[model samples]
Target: MTTTQRDHPSIIQADGEYLAAIATGRFYPGVLLFRSPDLTRWEQLPHPLEQVEMPESGIVLDPDLSYVDGVYHLLYGTALSASESGFADSPICHVRAPSPHGPWSPPVLLHAKGFHPSLYHESGRSYLLWSEWDHRPGRDSFGGTWAQEFYRGTRRLTGRAHLVRGGARGARLHRRAGWYYLVAGGIAVARSPHLTGPFHPDPHGALVAEGGPGCLVEGRAGEWWLTAWPEGGCALGSETVVRAVDWAGDGWPRVGDARPATGAAAPVPPGGARVPAEPGSTARADGRLPAEPELTAPADERPPAEPEPLTHTDDFDATELAFCWQSVRRPPDPGWLSLGERPGWLRLRADESPASRHRVSLLARHQHQDCEFTVLLDAQPTHFQQLAGLIHYTDHTRWHWLHLTHHEQLGRCLAVLTSDNGQLAAPADPLPWPNGPVWLRALLQHGELRFTASADGGSWTGIGPPLPVSRGFLGVCATDLTGARLVCDVDRMSLRPLSSPR
Candidate 1:
């Protein structure tokens, strides 16, 4: 996977176009959706689940999308408790809609057996597939892939769950040329003549032996393609990549070179040729797909141009926040966040402490590469309980904060705080600031972090010593440690990349 901070990508062809859904992990609105015409150049669609009320510290994981009989089914797991060993009490849920851009139905509970749930449909029947988590001592946590019958009309699962394939996780079932192929974690492939029978490992070995997990899809010309995320040193996290799949004479699929390539041929031709729909397809008339841009190159001839580094500026001029901004653990509640309250500024009411996982007034976007983030903050705290500033956040236990707070001796001041795995420390003494809106900036480059502040927008002054860090979310936050609801106004914010990672 390689672009724009996405994970566990699952793509399927629907209505002559390709659709993708990915896990949101610790963020609200469970899954993110995207559409493509040529298997490249994706446009983000409206999220399926808009408002999800999860348990405290619950996270959405491994979302999978599939289309059948005019309805698009989305399957995902919500992990209520997790540790380094494995997840506990993770429940798989299901939702369906007429289209990916949807007013989706409420999530229906499927089972709590495991995570990474996927739906497989055949002969007008649907089956739920997932990796079974084993907690026995001295045994692998990933027991195997299990399958059970799912009744769409009744909206419930029936029959006893049974193991289909063992020794691998994230197993996806596909049929090509009269053979059932089980691609597990993109690391191994097994074949079975029957859908629920003994599966044998491929004699030619796995299709992709290296890199991250992948999903296989057929192209417009009936050729095979692999949508995968190859592991590497990337600041933006894993990115989605497409590779060509070769079929052996013995009916096995193969990715010629196991390594991720920088470029590959386009799956469809210049005019965005549509794939032929399956036989007896009953797609609804209202399910119109998005328009695809016309390209100039022929199929398998030229690759699409690589996307440039991300740069964005938010003046809080719009009525609602853009899709790029995401809050931690919960959706941005209007009760604590507002754009119309102030004409041109964003008003954020302080929530719980920064260390609290339940609720925190923080809004951030993914940091894709070496970049600089600047914000104009206007906040005045009567005591040391309130803080508002820029943060480079990985999670609750790890982050770097450059905040403005009140000090007993120094009055209103600025300070730098660091948290490594929940161990908190103040790296620099507080610096007194004059009463007014201040421009705070954070520069992240080559795994090091530095902070600077400016009275005006031009001249900058360093505040804290350089500290080692890693790539994560960059955003502004306001918190009141004493539980008093204080307000922080952000006039403007911007981000620009210092260097691009190709």
Candidate 2:
């Protein structure tokens, strides 16, 4: 069966260019950006949030991108504070840039309502729509989708906030043919003549009921597509699945014919006649076929240059780190990690405890569905509880770690720890590892994780039984300890296909 792996997809077509934002936070860059000539062939663009550091224990969820009046805006939400019930108020943040690959403005707080905030522009007006949660008695955790207006220049919320639609969360807005359409939670769609009120819910109910949240994109040929994720038992992580939007005779946009997309092809807009390639022109580049361009758009709105294939592998050979390496909260401090400190090696100083959210020194890459990661660690631990090793992490809650540390009773040992929503479980006894440098390997196969270690860097020994790594895992979060300070020197860390050579 075929499936799409993109999730919480927010797409914008501006200046004849198509841009989609993928929600990736506390992993590598917070949001991953993609550009597509045709919605089918997407190319990774430079991530705008590569340097933005979200606080530890905080994560950016359901990112949205919009362009208006020459200014491009990006919005995302993060938990404002910890809550016991999993449903907590999160702050929606915004940033703007003149271009998608941008010198972006610093993040500005928009509101503390709920998650999945989206921005929409009309005629000359701007509006913010998001799910509102009510902790008050007798109200469902979610109060429903709410919206308010804002001044374009000020970027501040004005006017009273009002409920636009009821039911599911994750609100989105789009306008076509004098009618405004709203996508809620993912598949449930509604329409309204006025942007603010009186939205008409789909009588047929869910457009893609099982699908997660998504946004609408208008193709150059005037075709409307619902860029969403797979629904029902098929959904996984933040994976994305784009479905064709067909309008009923009554003018209501429906997602699909009810069935979840299983290798369903992306729909092309009418009038999307392919252009013949000319000699000496790389028109047929990156498998991206040419489509009809908006004659009304300025010349600069078209694809700039043929983008190179996005690389997930970083050798740490250069003095500077690549955008793929990210920490939980802030960008890793140079004092915590360095390439030049030890030539040909990435040195990580673990001065703070793993429990330290704000100042924790760690770096991780997003975990692919079927991949292998291997690293050589030269770690020396002096104090008990000082750990330097590999971890499969989601958030502060839900994680599994295998570390080389000094156990208070076991001296130098290798330990495994697992947490389900911050509740931890560990082996009663750690394996003795009073040896020199060791090689650690982590493999993710069908969403399960297996750990193995080698003292001589040749023969491998399994450390723990295979454990389920939740899709929520941000990636492999690791820390290093040095001297008496608990530091680990990672000579090299690599990620490759399970079938590829180690």
Per-residue lDDT tens digits for candidate 2, residues 1-502, read 0122455778878777688887765554678787777665666666777667665666677888988767778998887466556558688888877777676678889888787788877545566888886766666777777777655565677656767744257768777666677777647777666665567676776777656565678877778877655554442466666677876656667666773344444233233211122344323354232332222322335455344322245557888776556666666667677888888778877765445556666777655556777777778675665777887776666777788877677788888888877778884358989668787888888778888888886899888888887564333334433435555777767766553211
Q: Tell me the alpha-carbon RMSD of every candidate.
A: 8.2, 10.0
lDDT of 1 by residue, 4-121 (tens): 5677688888777777898777766668887777776666667787855755687888888988777788988988887465557889888887766676778898888888888887
Q: Quantify how close model 2 is to the true structure by its C-alpha RMSD in Å.
A: 10.0
Question: After TM-score superposition, what is the CA distance of residue 482 in candidate 2 from its true location, in Å?
Answer: 11
> Which lDDT values do the candidates have, in the order given?
0.75, 0.67
In model 1, which regions exceed 4 Å deviation? 84-87, 231-233, 258-309
TM-score of each: 0.86, 0.80
Worst window of 10 by summed lDDT in candidate 1: 266-275
Best-performing candidate as measured by lDDT: 1
What lDDT score is found at residue 496 in candidate 1?
84
Clashing pairs in 1: 1-229, 1-230, 1-239, 1-240, 2-239, 2-240, 3-239
